[model samples]
Target: MSHDRRRALARHDKDGADRDSGGDSGPDRVEERFLRPFAVAAGDPDGSGPGPGPETLDLLTLVVAARTPGRSEWLRPEREAILRHALRARTVVELAAEVNLPVGQVRAIAGRMIEDGSLQRCGPSRPLARKDILHAVLVGLRSL
Candidate 1:
């Protein structure tokens, strides 16, 4: 395994031990659960490479969170937290920082939320040029 992967696995194991020994509290336990799969995937004990890369989610993309629509439930509390945080307009980076998760993971989670329609991208509604604004002003003056 790569050095970084080994380090991550060690940290994960340490965190797991802490949980088992009751050294960690609520949020820490939640974080550990969220990170465990990433650690295992990184470790790749079978000598396989990392899993397929997640789709790119732009850090600047603005997302607005909403309820999952119907009875569909979130599988992970961490993801639900992410959705909750995104209830207001927030960039992927901001959500990541707020939730203390890696940006890539945040991106993946946001992408999934978007796919499930629990989040909506608040993209630029329109791009108005200075020329367009000036032209509109001139047209209004002519009409008046």
Candidate 2:
């Protein structure tokens, strides 16, 4: 390292513990984006990869938290992350991006969440009017 940079870093370090940037000198930025499927660690029901299959979640399936719980102590870390992102109503793919997991993993976890009543499916992920699909279809093409 250059002498000037080393001395400047040392001075900053001595200023206070609160000012330490943990080796970084700039605002936070996402330096990497990679899948960490191991954290989820699910295999096929018949013992294969965790890749999506029988769970059959369409890429566009909309997911929304069925209801906000006061405390969700029973959910796994992956499930919890999924639910947190679902509160805003996004598709399985979108939720995958939000949680930094693969789309297949998110779909699998989301399907299980739906079955357990932690999440509710309302058809397409887009935020069309009527809120949940339970509301009447007021969009055009009813005449078609």
Best by lDDT: 1
CA lDDT, every model vs. true structure: 0.67, 0.66
lDDT of 1 by residue, 44-125 (tens): 2342344455445788888888764333433455566777788788988999899888777678767666765777888656
Per-prediction CA RMSD (Å): 16.8, 14.0
Q: Give the Å error, residue 78, model 1.
A: 1.8
Residue-by-residue lDDT tens digits, candidate 2, 22-134: 44633232233434354454322333453444356788888899876435525456777777788977888989898888887787767766766888888653756656454
Whole-model alpha-carbon lDDT for candidate 1: 0.67
What TM-score does model 1 achieve against the real structure? Answer: 0.47
